[model samples]
Target: MTEHTSIRIRVTGHVQGVGFRAWTQARAEELGLWGWVRNVADGSVEAWVSGPAGAVADLVEALGHGPAAARVAAVETGPADAASDAAGAGFRILR
Candidate 1:
């Protein structure tokens, strides 16, 4: 069985008010990932993503460019303290 991993990602630049959260939700669900995406107070987009290692990596890579409306400046990733099931059943968009 594939090993599962969890990571926290913070995407900077032009990420707010650009459907970045909704776009991330779609991608995470498509990848069968469990996590939450939200717009940060600092004007960045943050996510706690958990899933198969490969899927997590793919999602991180995709976050680099983000939605067509987003102009991603940078993406920072690190180990997430939360468990894979922390987000529960599926991906979500947190307000």
Candidate 2:
């Protein structure tokens, strides 16, 4: 079986008010991942993603260039706790 991994990603630059969270949720779900994406007070997008290692890596890569409206400048990732809980079975957009 494939090993599961978890990561916390922070995407900077032109990520707010441009459907970044929604886009992230869709992408994560499409990759069969479990996580939550939210807007940060610092004008960046934050997400806690957990799933198959490959899928999680794919999601992180995609975050580098979000929705068409987004102009992503940087994407920072770090290890996340495995017990982090998502809102539902699939990916979710957190307020």
**In candidate 1, which residue pairs get closer than 3 Å at backbone N, Cα or C atoms, i.e. clash?**
none
Give per-residue CA lDDT, model 2, range 1-95, as digits (tens): 98888889999999999999989999999999988999999999999998899999999899998999999999999988767855347787889
lDDT of 2 at 81: 70
11: Cα error in model 1, Å = 0.1
lDDT of the candidates, in the order given: 0.91, 0.90
Cα deviation at 69, candidate 1, in Å, is 0.8
- Report how far off residue 89 is in candidate 1 (Å): 1.4
Question: RMSD for each model, in Å, please?
Answer: 1.5, 1.7
TM-score of each: 0.94, 0.93
lDDT of 1 by residue, 1-95 (tens): 98889999999999999999999999999999988999989999999999999999999999999999999999999989754457447898888
